[model samples]
Target: MRSLTVVGPSRVEWREAPSPELQEDTDVLVRPIASATCDLDRRLVLGDSPFKPPYALGHEAVGEVVATGDAPCGLRPGDRVVIPWHISCGTCAECGRSMPGACRSVHRLASYGNTAGGHWGGLFDELVRVPWGARNLVALPPDVDPVVAAFCSDSLVDAYRTVSPPLAAQPGATVLVVGGTASLGLLTVLSAVALAATEVFYVDRNPRSVQTAARLGATAMLITSYSEPVSGVFDLTVDASADTEGLRRALKSTRPGGTCVSRSVYFTEPALPYLDLYASGVTLVTGPPHATPHMPEVLRLLSSGALDPRPVLAGPYSYDEAPEVLRDPPPGKPAFAHPRAGAA
Candidate 1:
């Protein structure tokens, strides 16, 4: 088996590694049929991430279950499933509360690409070991394309979780997505539109990203200057860009009693205007997305053929080209496809 390893900043290579096996009765072995790069991965490659190198470097994947343990409820060998980025023991207290991403029993931040939660390896490998299969894996419907479903492991699911709950809390709310033309920002735009926000405003300087947002039903605006006052009209704002300006804009964009959600994983010290936020009476929320809880609803939307992630999929590459693809993503979601392999 080969896995994509990030040796250092702007350095990535494919290394032959031992294939993963089912180490526990609840574990399942999967062959990645399709895998995509997360926007955060670009930051990791540029040495902008807090996570160090010499580890597997992918987290989003859709794959075929090659083998499963005897204990199972909905999955089987040959079933196409979406693997969540985080490795969680579903029976933990946090997982029981429908917050598997914050499960205390599992290693904190136990993700496939990072070493934070123990090295479970990355999805950019030929084989992956999924622990707690019954609770974490979401079987993709036959009709959904593996390329589109690949994002369900992270971005799509994250988008769904970010928008749906907050929107449900406040129907017909105006939402603002503060970020660049990156995948996370774009997905946030799409999610806002899909959830039927009264108005979806995307802030970014890149014309390409702004164009992408416009095509996806968002009012794209170029951020020429940070000093300009953010139009404080939104009920909810999602800051996928973890920069200081992005955060400030998100806080300022929301109404006095509005909520702001930060989805970006910031590795640096983001200078925040605490006094301004306090004065505005803003409610700030930020965390890793609970993808396990949102996967079902995301899949349902994909199955219904109402949601199209193709706009977000910038490119699709061969499995052998994983190293180069991560180094320089073409544009949007760069998905790796294996023709011989089953749908991921």
Candidate 2:
């Protein structure tokens, strides 16, 4: 099997790897129908992230089951499924409480692509071994367009997980979104609108993303000058921008007694305005999204056609072109479909 390997900064290549076998009766093998570069993958590939190289390079993929072990899983050989980015034992204490991202059975960070995550080999592989298949695989409707549906493995649902809670608490609240490099920023803008924010304001430096935000129903602005205070104005604010300056602006934008959620993972410590944050009595949320907990709600929204991720689709790259596309994943998150997956 061929696996996409990231050798170093801006260098990606294909390497022959042994096909994964079913080590347990519960094991299953899946061939990815569609996959895309995730936010963390984009940051590490395009910039200086702490992750080292020579590792299999992707974690977001929607796949077709090709083989199943003798154990009876509700799934069969032809079912399509979303492979979660993090590994979890559905029976564990933390997992039972909906904290699979911090599952105790495996290393706290165990996942497919990154080295810190037990190096389970990325979803970019031709064949992926899924342990505890029944627990891990989330079956999709047969009619799903794998290209738009691919992000269920990570970002798309994560976007919903970020905005849902705050909006649920205060329906029709005004929202301010600070966006930067990751596709999550754009998706969050879309999610906020779908969740019925009374007003949505998006601030980003990227012209392309700002335009996309407009099409998705948000009032978009390209971040130019933050000389004036933009804080204490919005009921809820999301900071997906990896930039420090943007994060502070987002935090400041939250109204007194409102909420601000940040989804960026940064290596260097960002300087924060503690006094201002303290004075506002604002609620701040920042951490790994427990994606599984919100899957049902997000999947329902997508399947119902209430939300559309198609506008953010950049490409359906040929399987062979995956390495290059992923090296610097496009502004709109790029999706990859194997020719065998029936790409139109």
Candidate 3:
């Protein structure tokens, strides 16, 4: 088996690796049909992030079950499924509390791609072993395109988290998404719109991004200057921009007593407007999303035709192109597919 491994800044190579095997009765083997890169992966490839190199490079995918253990998982070989990034036991205390990302039964950060969690291997590998398969895999709807659902593992779920709960709590709420993290911001915009935000306002300097957001029904603004926050407040605000200015703007724009969730991963701590947040009584939430719990809603939205993430995706590149394409990824999110999985 050959897995795409990030060797250093701006470099990736196909490394021959041992194929994974089922280790538990609840385990399953899957062949990745479609895998998408994360913003962190782009940063690592561009030499712009803090994580060191020589690790497996992907965590998002839609896979086909190659084999299932004897545990009666209601799944079978050839069934396509959405593989969540986190490795959780589903029955753990943390998972019971809806925090599967911190499942106590696995290594502290147990997940695929990053070995810091455990050497669970990458979704880009030719084959993967899914532990606690029944709890971790979500069967993909037959009518949905696998490539369109590839990001369901992480990115889509993360974006969905930013807006879904808040919008549900405050129906027809106004949303402000300061986007610089590429597809995440746009995906967030799409979710807000699909979930019925009365107004979705997106801020980004990229013309393509702004244009895309506008096409998705957001009041998109291309602001090269972020020294000032967008005028007016919103019921909810999101800092999808990986920049400090963007975070500050999003925080300041939150309506009094409203919530602002920062989806950006700041490797280096950035100075924040503490007084502004305090004075306005705004609640700021940050951290990686608990992807598994929120996945079903995301899929339901997709299945019901209430959401379509394909607008923000680019490329159904062949698996053979991963090493080269990942080195310098495409403009929008890139989806790599197996030649035989019949991905679109």
Candidate 4:
């Protein structure tokens, strides 16, 4: 088997590695059919992040189950499933509360590619070992394509989780998404639209990203200058852009008592205005998305054919080309397909 290994910043190679097997009775082995890069992975690859190198490199994937331990009859060897980025024991206290990203017991819960929690190995490999399969793996609907469903593993689900909770509490409220063409940002746009927000405004300096947002159903604008206060304040603002200034603008653009949700994984110290935030009475919440909690709902929406993520896919390439593609993805989701390796 071959796995994509990151030897250093801006360095990656496809190297021979052992094929994963069930390490425990509660574990399962999956072969990814389609996998895509997370924006965080891009940051790690560019050396702009704190994540160290010499680790397996991907986390988002959709695949078919190749084998299972003493898990449950619900999943089988041939079943197609969407693998979540985080490994969690479904019964844990945190998971029970719909916060699997903060699962307490798992020491360094592994994601597919990076070594944030532990070296789960990258989904960019031939095989992946999933622990607590019964609880973590979500069966994909027959109608959903593995390429599209792969985004659900992280970006899509994260966007849904980030926007839905706050927006649900305040129905028909305005929502603002702050970010450029990042997958998380785009998904935020999609989620906001699907949730029927009174209005979805996207702020980004990248013309391409802003255009993409508008096509995805948001009123896209460039935040060239913030001198004048933004009009039509929002009830909820999501800062998916890893920009500190953008986040500050999001906080300022939000209405009083509005919630600001930040999904950016800032690897470095970003300047913030605490006093301003305090004075505005804004609520700030930020963290790695608890994607598992929103997986079922996102799947339902994708399967309904109402929200299409196809436009978000920039291009597709063979699994062998993943290393180079990750180094320089053109735009949108660059899907990696390995039919022989099975669906992830």
Score candidate 1 by lDDT.
Answer: 0.83
Task: Assess every candidate by TM-score.
Answer: 0.95, 0.95, 0.96, 0.94
CA deviation > 4 Å runs, candidate 3: none
Which of the two, 3 or 4, has more TM-score? 3
Best by lDDT, which number?
3
Per-residue error for 288 in candidate 4, Å, reads 1.3
Worst 10 residues of 4 by lDDT: 335-344
Residue lDDT tens for model 4, 52-106: 7788888888888889897564788878888899988888788899888888867
lDDT of 4 at 68: 89
The lDDT-based order of candidates, best leading, equals 3, 1, 2, 4
Question: How good is model 2 by TM-score?
Answer: 0.95
Model 4 stretches astray by more than 4 angstroms: 225-229, 340-344
Worst 10 residues of 1 by lDDT: 224-233
lDDT of 1 by residue, 108-154 (tens): 88888888788899998889999988888888788888878889888
How many clashes does the backbone of model 1 have? 3
* RMSD in Å for all candidates: 1.6, 1.9, 1.6, 2.0
Better of 2 and 3 by lDDT: 3
